[model samples]
Target: MEKRYRLRKNLEFRKVYNNGKNFWNRNLVLYIRKNDLEETRLGLTITKKVGNAVVRNKIRRRLKEIYRLNLYRVKDGYDLIIIPKKNVVDISYKELESALIHILKISGMLKG
Candidate 1:
C-alpha cells in the first residue's frame, strides 16, 4: 500500500522480466536472480490482455496482498517478479495464494 515498499516502475519490472531466470512450481511462476541491494526487491506485472486498467489494477492489488501477507515466508536477497496469467483473473484468493506459495517452495525460497 506504500510506494516505499512497492517495486514500482516499468523499467525495474522489465529488467527482471527480460533478464531474470525463471522457475515455476504450479500456478506460481517466479523470476529470481541476484539483486544489488541488501534487501529483496519485488515486482508484479499484468498486461492489458488481463483486462482494462481496472482489472489490471485489481490483479496487482491482489498480488500485493499476497506478497504482503506472505512476506515473512519469502526469503531475502533476490530480486523477484511475479506475472499472473489470464486464467488467474477468475481464480479465488485462496488459489492465488497457494500458487504463490507453491512456486516459492519450488524455487527453494522457502525451506522447512
Candidate 2:
C-alpha cells in the first residue's frame, strides 16, 4: 500500500479508535472512521497476546495483503484499523480474507 493510504501514526490510530464505529468477529475487530482524504487508509494492530515478533509480523503481512487485494471493493474516505484475535494466527488465508470481507460488509464499505 502507498504511504498516504497507510495509517502510520499513533495519534491517527487513536483518533480512529475513539471516533470510529467498530465491527467484531471471532477472529478480528475492525474500527472505521471518516477521513478528509479521498482514499481510505488502513491501520493494523496485532497485540503481544497474539504471539512473538515473528508471529505478529506474519499476521500483519497477511492482513495487509488481504486489504490490498480487496481495496477496490471498499468505500473511500475512511480510516480503518484491524486487530486480529489470538486464534487468527492458526487460520488459513481464505479464512482471514473472509473475516475481513465480512467486517467490511458490516461497516457498509464493501461495494456490490
Candidate 3:
C-alpha cells in the first residue's frame, strides 16, 4: 500500500531567485517564504541548469530522500523550498543528509 502526507498548495514553489537566502558553511541553499497555511508543504525545483533529465532526476531523488528521512525533524506552519547546488551531485547520501540537517538546524527547526 502507498502512504502520503498532508501536502497542500501553500507549499507551492515560489521564486526568490537572486533574492534567495543562503547559509554559508552549509551545503544546502534554501529559498524560504512564508505561506499562509497550517500544514507544511514542499516544492522542489530542479532546472535544466542543474543538468540533463537523468542528472536532474537524480538530484531530485536525493533531495526527496533527504526530506523524507528528516521530515519528522521539521516544524510546521511554513513553506520550504530547497534548491541544490551543482556541488550536490558529487556528494553521497550521507553527505547530503548532513547538509540537509545543517540547513534545518540553521533554520531553527532542529535542536542540538
* Per-model TM-score versus the true fold: 0.83, 0.97, 0.75
Encode model 3's per-residue lDDT on 3-45: one tens digit a residue.
3232334324433333435453445677655546654566666
Q: List, in order, the clash count of every candidate structure.
A: 0, 0, 0
User: In candidate 2, what are the lDDT values of residues 4-47, reduced to their tens digit?
Assistant: 88999999999999999999988999999999999999999989
Question: What tens-digit string does per-residue lDDT give for candidate 1 at 8-96?
Answer: 78877777778878987545568977667656778887777778898888878888898888877877777788888788888888898
Best by TM-score: 2
| Per-model CA lDDT versus the true structure | 0.78, 0.94, 0.66
Candidate 3: regions farther than 4 A off:
1-11, 15-26
- Model 1, residue pairs in steric clash: none
The TM-score of predicted model 2 comes to: 0.97
Name model 2 segments beyond 4 Å from true: none
Candidate 1 accuracy as TM-score:
0.83
TM-score of 3: 0.75
For model 3, which pairs clash?
none
Over the full model, what C-alpha lDDT does candidate 3 score relative to the true structure?
0.66
